[model samples]
Target: MHILILPSWYPNHANDIKGVFFRDQAQALAHYGHTIGVIALQRRSLRTLFPKKQNNKAPHFELDEGVPTYRCQVLEALPKIPYGNYFLYKRAAKTLLANYVEENGWPDLIHAHSTLFAGAVASEWGNENNIPVVITEHNSGFALNIYRPWQLKVADKATQGAQACIAVSPSLGEVLDQRLPSSKGRWEWIPNVVAERFNAPASKKYSAGPTRFLNLALMTEKKGQYDLLYGFSKLIGGGTKAELWLAGDGPIRAALQELANQLEVSSQVRFLGQVAPNQVPSLLQQVDAMVVSSHYETFGVVAAEALMAGLPVIATRCGGPECIVAEGDGLLVPPRDPQSLASAMDHIAKNLSEYSPHAIAERSKSRFSGAAVAAQLTYLYTRLLTSNSKVSQPKS
Candidate 1:
């Protein structure tokens, strides 16, 4: 099976941490014996804004972690141009497909990471070549609410044309269903996968701390970092003895740091900005629990990782986390409620033995392992390919 992935968020020289999950999936697919290739698209604007020293050396194609990647530049930079940037995405996808077909032969199926503009491009390419297209929608609640009318219309069109749709969680799939009901495609609920590397011995060794709580997301407004800090402050104020590890970097880092300072819990929270994907497991094993305060997540990959790390997770009643954190795995509080979040933290601190970090990690294997997810995805692609083959055959 020649599997081609069209991921809008892919790691590049400038943003090496971007879409590391998608890269993991691609690697898993390749390991499954599928002839996998990728057409990773980067916004031209982003590339120019952070021009790598290697930019002038031609578009050097390379194999990353065993997957063949063809990086194509999309925009000169994020365009402030007008109402919609549909043209930029379409042009990039068109160029990618053209180059892919010319150089590497046709792929059996194309799986797009987002239902944003990327789906439109995949639909166009699939239509042109009669190839099957599948889309995995990964968007926040805010984006879903703020999308323009035409954006929804384009998504509807693409959804209708797709062979199947995989939603990371039920809430996201429900939103997709409401937005585009006419699309005659099977919608499957596929959660994100965490790599085996994230699963480690809790007390075996190499953990950063003995009793730690971690927030492994970019520090941003939508991620609710400020709320997390406030909740942590409340927990500390209540005399809880736990260290907070804040991983990942974003625009809100300085502001969040200031908030921690104002709350006088700056020393308790360690900002370990941008840890590599491979290092996540060892880092997580050091922690006792993970906190996910994000208002929305298409799928909480870190929460799953924490579960895989055998650390209980304390997540908000946000769309994705509510679905992922089953009974006994963790607790969920209302989004943005510091009091409730703080209370949950206190409960965990007091009854640490109730939430077995090892049990939670074991439970995470079913939902977020690379091998499990890749098998499900491969099955979806194979089914679509076989169906397409039957349709194109001459009548018996």
Candidate 2:
């Protein structure tokens, strides 16, 4: 089967982490013996015009890690005009689709990531061409209630038109079903694939030190980093020997640092700003446990990565983490509750030896590895295709 993917945002460069899961999923499908291609459309603000980057008018094609990819950048010329950016996106997408079909022929199915724009575009094109469309929504906006009225309308149309719609977590699926009741029965949940590097055996042995707990995410209020800091401070006050390592950079870094100082836990908390994606697996090996304190998440991907690296997680009962952190895999606490978080951290520190790294990693592989996700996707694709064929057949 031939599958074409439309991702709302993609890595502009090799190290860009935006929408990387879409790329990984495309590669996984290709590895499963299905032909795969990607069309990534980037909408740049007018400010980028001053830098005078490479030509943005034309689309470019490349073989990205053996998967055919086409990328184009559209400058948002009329920001104040209603629906201006979306019109530009639709125009660029049509041209790219024409070029792709000319070179690679029509695909058996179109898989779109996110519903705001990509899913809308894919649904339009697929309907016109008589092709089945599958939309996998990875946006946190639905959970955050942040989408504009117009944006929600677009999402609804896309969801209603698609043959199938998927959410990255079950909790997210429930939210979409309630918000977009017309598409309720079509929604399904699937976990994202963990990178193979994370699945590799631990390369470094854990050295004896103060039990280190890692929190890897952008330093933001919604991420609940402040809550993590408060919890860590409480753990110290209770006479626990532990160090909190916070990774990733954001606009609130200085604010978080100030709070740590105010709480008098500055020395115990280390801010490792913006660790690269390739370094994450090794970092996981060095830490004793991982902590996710987000208020809400479409899917807590970092938690899955830590589990794949054989590290236990202490996650809040935020929407996504509740699905990932199973019994004995880790402990789940209520989100934004510093006392509960501190208690869970202390428990993990005391019973660190009880958590089996090998068993944790093995369980993660069965659910999140590339092969595992690919098989599930292939089954969905075949079923959709078979159903489409019967519906399109003429009366015998």
Candidate 3:
């Protein structure tokens, strides 16, 4: 089986961290003996200043993590186009597809990660070629109520034309059902793939200082970093000797840091911006626990990773974390509630010895591993293949 994955977010030279999970998933699916290729439509507008070194490159084609990938640049270096941009993107995608088909032939299936422009492009192409398209949505923007109307409209069309819709978590599926009723029946659940490297149970090391709680996210408002700050401050006020390490970089980093300063938790919080994906395991092993305070998540990949690291996660009642963080593995609190989050943080600080790292890692194997997810995805793709066969053949 051959698959062409169109991820809305994909790691690139400029943004190496973007959609790394999608690449991980592609590799995981490839592990099951399925040939996988990926492509992403990345547009550069005036808001982003491209590096001078990559100015000459166009139609960037390379093997991303051993999987053949093509990142076709849409309209770049253009002044205020003031448009939907998908029109330009779709045109570029169509042209890229022609080149892609000429080289690798038509893929057995086209899978889109997130229902933004990628799903839309795949849906349009699928309709034209009589191919089966599957969309696996992972963006939290929809559930967080920050997505635009145009984005939703495109996703809706993608869902309508899709053979199936997949959500990383049941909670995300529910959100999609509410937003697009047409896909309610077609929705399926498959979790994100976490590397086996992190599956080693952490040896919880107690340093001669504050207990460390690691929060790995984009540091955005939707991620509820402020809530984590307030919660950590509460723990500090309660005389809990613990510190919070805020990882990842985003637009909210400065504001979050300022908030931390204002809340007097600046001394207890360490802002570690943009840790590489490969380094997560070591960081998780060092930290006593993980905190995910996001308002919503399509799937809390980090929470799953934390479990893989044998670290208990204290996540919010956000969409995906509820599905990922099980009882005894971690604690769940109300989203955006600092009091609740602080209480949970303090509880973990005092009762750190109660959680078994090895048990956490062992239990997470079936649900979050790359191979585990690949098996489920393979079965789904096989069903889609069968469906395609039924459609291609005569009614007799």
Query: RMSD per prediction, one decimal?
Result: 3.4, 2.9, 3.2
Q: How many residue pairs clash in each candidate?
A: 10, 0, 0
Query: Taking the tens digit of each residue's C-alpha lDDT, what string does model 2 give over 40-59?
Result: 99878998877756743433
| Best candidate, lDDT | 2
What is the C-alpha local distance difference test score of each model? 0.78, 0.87, 0.82
Pairs with backbone N, CA or C atoms under 3 Å apart (clashes), candidate 3: none
Off by over 4 Å in 2: 52-59, 200-206, 390-396
Q: Write the per-residue lDDT of candidate 1 for residues 1-396, one digit (tens) a residue.
A: 888888877878533667878887888788878988888877655535555565433253787766778886665443554424677778777887788777877777888888677777887678767788898888673235877776777778888778888888887777777767665345689887677777757564323333577899987898998888998899898887777889989999999989989999989999999987767777876678889998888788888878887888899987888877999987999999989889988887777777766677677887788888888988877788777753253211
Best by TM-score: 2
lDDT of 3 by residue, 19-76 (tens): 8788788888888788898887777775555465665353479875678888776664
Would you give me the overall lDDT of model 1?
Answer: 0.78
State the number of backbone clashes in model 2: 0
Candidate 1: clashing residue pairs, number: 10
Higher-ranked by lDDT: 1 or 2? 2
Q: What is the lDDT of residue 162 in candidate 1?
A: 81
Reference-based TM-score of each model: 0.89, 0.94, 0.91
Question: Which scores better on TM-score, 1 or 3?
Answer: 3
Q: Please list the residue runs of candidate 3 whose C-alpha ends up more than 4 Å from where it truly belongs after superposition.
A: 49-59, 76-83, 147-150, 201-208, 390-396
